[model samples]
Target: MARQNTVHAAAAVLVVVPTYNERENLATLAPRILAQGEQFHLLVVDDDSPDGTGPLADELAAADPRVRVLHRASKGGLGPAYIAGLTTGMKRGFDYLVTMDADHSHDPADLPRLLAATHDARADVALGSRWTAGGSTRGWPLRRRVLSRGGSAYVRLVLGVDLRDATAGFKCIRASALAALEIDTIGSSGYAFNIELNYRATLRGFRIVEVPIVFTERITGASKMSGRIVAEALLRVPALRTTSLRPLADVRPLADARPT
Candidate 1:
């Protein structure tokens, strides 16, 4: 379903980018995203970066009516920041909600493809995968590559999910899926949070399709991956397995979920 230019759709798509000390990257990332299409909007969730990313985001938002900002008091975990941004998007009633990295890792150019993939398949979730067919990562060292691909494999193995890139951070999820997820109840953070969302989507009978994307490593800033985050992911994966995740009933179809 790829196209020459951006795939035009009437439904509002909110791209929620979580930022912390990403001032340099955010300055360049915003315009490229807003250029994709008029229907595509951006919500920058800033975690009170010492580098003044919050103010920069405010500047961008002030310049463009489509851009909006949500400022948090401190640097919370990635999962919570995303939850806050996505929760805001949901409350504002966006038809599609996207989770993208701000470090220039997830290409702004791929935004249209993701939107098209989800739209054409009528999927509730569009996973911008690095392990799926035609998907790959760039500017990554062998060790980092091993960790990322291996982590995805491990999550699939332990969770019994068919997702190829289970630990992937870039995704487009419909608000209907978010509503079923019960935004306030989800607590998983970082890579584990991505895994949990995809897992829950499957349980809720949401059709999730993987779209190929070349994930480039960020050159402007330091990596956020820590031993503590890794350990947390290891511990949380199993807890999700043991815990009861009762599927929601009386579920609506894709057509019904779309905004009129």
Candidate 2:
């Protein structure tokens, strides 16, 4: 899909933050996202968090017009939660959609910078990458860093994707580019979902740009990573190399609209 001719400053941008049990983080994260700029709106997708994050998201939505919450009946995994949020944001006429972590690992302060890069670079997708030049991580042990770097390398070698950080979660995607993707057909559910989406974007010939970012470890909340998630990524990467993807199409652009 070619870049839309509309001016990005006037575009409606929706930031989708997927949360499991992030009540403590949302309290601080929500306000920071809203403070980014007037063009930004926030969508918190909660998977029936046991820690009351869902109701807290409701409260935030009630308090601010720029904030909205999507409640899931059960924990369906990260990929489904994000897909639901992105579909809702697109249906409501957002020109751009951002996906990020709610645990503060992906900084809200970098939100504007990511959005700007997508527009300035005329990129269909802009990834906040830790492996790229000037990008780094904080509060991680050497083993964790090695695992992350190794995972990226493995995905690159198997999938032949050029992105430095193929599994990066922080991203700014043009709505048209997203609509072109067969999101309903994506099979990966864990962190591998990030890699699949990036790969699909590349397959469709979308211009993807990497924006250097400092990924911070979450201070609160338990980590969601598990052996099962790791196993899923390991099995899914090689499978994706041979999988045939659907062709891209130019979907209708969001009405030159803004949230009231």
Candidate 3:
């Protein structure tokens, strides 16, 4: 399916980019996002950064009618920034909202496939998955790939989420799915946020589909991954599973609950 046709089939897609110190990457990515041959808009929610990413986002917004910028007071966690962007997109009447890394790890070329999946498959949420068929990562070191695969595996095994890439940052969410999501109640704000959203969506019975995409290394800037971040994700896995299963507790067990 063509980008234009896919976009028209859904409500206008508003790409929500939460930026912090991404000035070097923003300029090139912003225009490319606009030129995707789709009726999508972009919202840049920038946490105040010494690197001037916020100002550059403002400049981009001024130049492009489809681009908008939101300035946060300080460098907040990723989860809060995304929540702000999603809220803004919904309030502005966008039917679809997408979030992705700003450092170019996510390929703009693959965006059309995600939108097409949302349209053609009637998916409430479309994920750009690296673990699924035809999906792969390029130029990543062995350690990085192992980390990603391990994180995804841990999430699936713990939360019972079958998504190939439970921690994928690249995702397209239908407006109805967003509305159905209890965004405010989500607690995790880092890599764990991706797992939280997918788990919650599954628990709510939303239809999710994955599209394979080649994830490339960011052309600029250093990675934000940290040991602390990884540790936090490990801690949050059980929390997500517990939260997800709590609601279903009222349903009587089909067979007596098996001991772990």
lDDT of each: 0.82, 0.85, 0.80
lDDT by residue for model 2 over 24-121, one digit each (tens)?
A: 99999999887777788999999999999999999999998999999999999888888999999989999899999989999988877777666655
**Residue-level error in angstroms, candidate 2, position 80:** 0.7
Off by over 4 Å in 2: 1-8, 245-260
Q: lDDT per residue, candidate 1, 1-260, as tens digits?
A: 12424355577989999999999999999998988888789999999999999999999999999999999999888999988999999999998899999998999888877776566557778888898878899989999989988888888788777777888789888788888887567778776778777778877777777787899989898888899999988888888886566552222322333422
Give the candidates in order of lDDT, highest first.
2, 1, 3
Show pairs that collide, candidate 3.
none
Candidate 3 residue runs with Cα over 4 Å from true position: 1-10, 244-260
What lDDT would candidate 2 get against the real structure? Answer: 0.85
| Candidate scoring better on lDDT of 1 and 2 | 2
What is residue 230's positional error in candidate 2, in angstroms? 0.6
TM-score of each: 0.91, 0.91, 0.91
Instruction: Write down the worst ten-residue block by lDDT for model 1.
Output: 248-257
